[model samples]
Target: MSTFQAPKGTYDLIPPHSATYLAVRDAIAAPVRRAGYGYVETPGFENVELFARGVGESTDIVTKEMYAFETKGGDRLALRPEGTASVLRAALQAGLHKGGNLPVKLWYSGSYYRYERPQKGRYRHFSQVGAEAIGAEDPALDAELVILAHDAYRSLGLRGFRILLNSLGDAKCRPVYRAALQEFLRGLDLDEDTRHRIDVNPLRVLDDKRPAVRSQLADAPLFRDHLCEDCRAYHAQVRELLTAAGIAFEDDPTLVRGLDYYTRTTFEFVHDGLGSQSAVGGGGRYDGLSEMIGGPALPSVGWALGVDRTVLALEAEGITLELPASTDVYAVPLGEEARQVLFAQVTELRRAGVATDLAYGGKGLKNAMKSANRSGARLALVAGERDLAEGLVQLKDLTSGEQRPVALDALVDEVRKALD
Candidate 1:
């Protein structure tokens, strides 16, 4: 019989390599954790209407990409394509917003599902570290999230990514720009679907990448030009803050990231080395998302750093993370008596805060020694009836190829001392 494998467009994180992924996740979440953003977790799936209403019906994520289904009980649900809507939903449901904190800062890390043709850096299921500052709208708050994300990438030795910044205007001025943009798009020689998209959300047409669509949009209306005074000032403050912090950014007039909740500031992190799927991650201010999701008015800003994409970015830059050894010691037991003795010592070493592994299956010394070497351990413990009878065990330094004897009673202390 053939063995079953993981479904297509998915992957399993195995040892050695999986360590790098963990380190990447830690590096991305570090800055957010230090900034007082408490961790938040939501179910893999939520009401399908959450994305439909909060992510916007006009988005491809809602119209196409999302993994939605009806439960056996007849409730409509979806595996979240992104984080903001669900995070905000959780905060509101738990009354976290009702707390004294104006913008209830929260961070999340999880796998989000979307059904799409998987490619390098794009997956049917992907992992992300997301941060949200809900219930407030301040340029400084917006600037802070961007700065934190910038610091995150830098912390991991990533320098090839660029921050693409823009403002989508707000309710006060977006309708005017939308109408003008709609008029401009309606005049183009577009397909039926493209023409219909202009009526639903004209800004989306700006994101069209086809050469034919791009040629016509050359003179299209820009959000930067239509920004109301308030939005302009808000965007200017965010830019100034970023500039003052020595973070460089490009003003992308047409970056309407694949979301509908974004209003005012919208920014994306693009790594030039990643090609085509250059967006490592992005997020922006969602001032109306709370109301759209049936919560009280709460203006928010957030960003999610793609763990998988960031790992790819690290590779694209030819950088490898410094990951610590998983096993500090490997125990080799030659005989049944020695096995029991070494097994207890292994437990003792572990209890003393030492990372220890045991060579199982009664392998011979040569084979067990090979196992120890493969474990990336600094030390290998070997014992037989003779060594144990003498109240001693062989502690071999794998790095230096030096062997020594230590009293069985003092084993843990000796291992700790050697490791330190």
Candidate 2:
């Protein structure tokens, strides 16, 4: 028989490596929870049109990257390529934004699938920790989302990250900018696909990395220059709020987010140390997303941080997170009677909130002690038949290798005190 491994571009997080993934997740979620954002979970897949309309039909994600398929019942579905669209769909479906609260604050952490040509830091499937503040259109809300993302990155001890901010302009001014940008793009001697992109989403033309296109784009129309009065005022307030909160950012006119739904304020967190796959995570104001998906005119702003890319960025910076110990106490029992007695004792320890684990199989004392050390346990509880007969259990401080006998009744308390 042959054994098949995890599919290419997909990874199985196991053992000590899985520990890092969990640590990263907890670190990112801690600040979000403290910010009064409740956790929300949606289905892994939704109707294909949900993304095609919500994420924008013109963006590469909906057109190329999505893992979409037809169901046996003939319904078209797609594994969510990102979290925000699904989250918004659920919030709208549940009527969370029906004037109950101004902004329905939500934070979610989960896996997202994107069928791309997998490369370093880019995969077929990945996980993300995203947050959305829907139902509000205030500029301070945009600043708050940026602050939350910055806090998440700082909490992970990450440096070398630059927050790039831009305004994609609202419906009031974006149409004018789009026409001017398309006219310039049409005059260039571009490939058929590049020309097609101009008709689909001219702003994505700025996102192209090709040297020739970039050289020609230097003369492209700037969005900041064409912003209408309302968009200009909104952009000014968002910058002011960010300044008041001591969050540093760079205003790049060329920073066009990939998705079509994004409008007005757009931002991205980029890490220079991660090589070409430098975009750790980013998001922006999707003011028209609700209406685009056949819902009411609900405007919102949010961001999604890539957990996998953030981890790689941390690694690239040589930052190591000190993972908590897996076991607080390793209870090793010798002989059958002591095993049964210690099993009961460990249960009590666990009830007292002490992390305790015991040897699964009957290994020798030497082998068992080795397991204790490997678990990163601070204390090892040793119980033998002779010690049990005397109503005593031995406690060995793994760090000091000092062994002492304690009364069975005092075992839990003694271990707790020793740990402290």
Measured by lDDT, the strongest candidate is 1
Q: How displaced is residue 40 in candidate 2, in Å? A: 0.6
lDDT, candidate 2, 244-278, per-residue tens: 99999999999997888899999999999989899
Positional deviation of residue 35's Cα in model 2 after best superposition, in angstroms: 1.5
Query: Candidates' TM-scores?
Result: 0.98, 0.98
**Candidate 2 clash pair list:** none
Q: Write the per-residue lDDT of candidate 1 for residues 269-312, one digit (tens) a residue.
A: 99999988899999999999999999999999999989999999
How far off is residue 232 in model 2, in Å? Answer: 0.8
Clash count, predicted structure 2: 0
